[model samples]
Target: MVTFQFIPFQEIENLGSAKRVNKLLNIVKENKIVLMEGRLKKQEEADLIEITMEEISPKFKGIELSVVYPNKSKQDFGQKVKGTFANLLLGDRQGMTIIGPASVVKRIEQNPNKIELFTKEAKTPPAKRYRKKK
Candidate 1:
């Protein structure tokens, strides 16, 4: 069975750019998809891409990153108001960021409403056959 690794925004928020990238790189190297709770800063994201690209070699696959934007519609009054205040304090809205191996992530659909990663079906061993005595 395939499993995903989830990293909360708060966990990496205090970390420096280099440390953050290193942490992310380590996770992706394990062939696991990372579902990050919040978006990465522009500079942090760029640095990550640059460092990751340089690390890519014949044996290593680079990462694919995608952002999941938040929906403003359909929220109740309390939620909408809270979101607005948070945005004002934070300067912008935060979204989910997906990071994974390029080979595996290439098959994922990056839609804001629905993000999907398509993994290969598990294989089963064939049954053994025996011939009756002739």
Candidate 2:
């Protein structure tokens, strides 16, 4: 069965960058998809990918990550200014981040209107046939 875990920004707001990345990675390693409240800083995102690569193994195939944020191109000047101020004061809590294990999540696609997350189907072992012996 597939599992999803929601992580609020407040939950990791106080954590160091490494801790935050590790926390998310740990969840992903468990084969659960993580829906995070905010996007990580650019550097932190890189670090997460780097760490994931290093941890790739037979049991841990790595992660699929994506971030979705508002598009500012169509926003008015005043709206942009307000958004900047809000980000400055409240941290970068404007977007959503998704992290899932590669073994489960096949891919993640994002567009201005929506996000599509495709997951890999579970592979069940074949049943064994038995015959009576004389």
Candidate 3:
């Protein structure tokens, strides 16, 4: 029912990220996902730093991509939750992907049936606080 797009880091870099923030801003789309890899580069040696989408918003506003954190929606998405990340890593997960909550994303994948989204929904929201008894 929901429609969204997923973009990669390479495509974003090509768009002329006047400042890294500019590139991050351009990719912010509703229910969309961003696949990225970030490592700190230094003149001599580089260290990999795992950065979350929330850290990319130099301005720290939602910047179109909403952030969802666990058990908290009291503050803005960008402020509290950090960018919503999928629990199951997709593709080269050591890298990262940005996306909406699973329900919207479930619709984006191929041959989506109620079975997929419903299955996750049935198990998650209620379990946010306590693990459901087996």
| TM of each candidate vs. truth | 0.72, 0.88, 0.25
lDDT (Cα atoms) of all candidates against the true structure: 0.78, 0.92, 0.33
How far residue 26's Cα lies from its native spot in candidate 3, in Å, is 3.4
What is the C-alpha lDDT profile of model 1 across 12-126, one tens digit per residue? 8788889988898889888788888877788888998999989898766788787776677867889899888887876323778888877556667875468777655556679
- Residue 92, candidate 2: C-alpha displacement in angstroms: 1.6
* Best candidate, TM-score: 2
The lDDT of model 1 is: 0.78
**Which residues of candidate 3, in runs, are more than 4 Å off?**
14-20, 29-31, 37-94, 99-134
Q: Which is better, 1 or 2, measured by TM-score?
A: 2
Ranking by lDDT: 2, 1, 3
lDDT of 3 by residue, 46-81 (tens): 111122343444343332222212333454866443
Model 1 poorest ten-residue lDDT run: 87-96
Top lDDT model: 2
Q: Order of candidates by TM-score, top first? A: 2, 1, 3
User: lDDT of model 2 at residue 123?
Assistant: 91
Cα lDDT tens digits, model 2, 18-112, are 99999999999988999999889999999998999999999999899999887889789999999899889877677889999999999999888
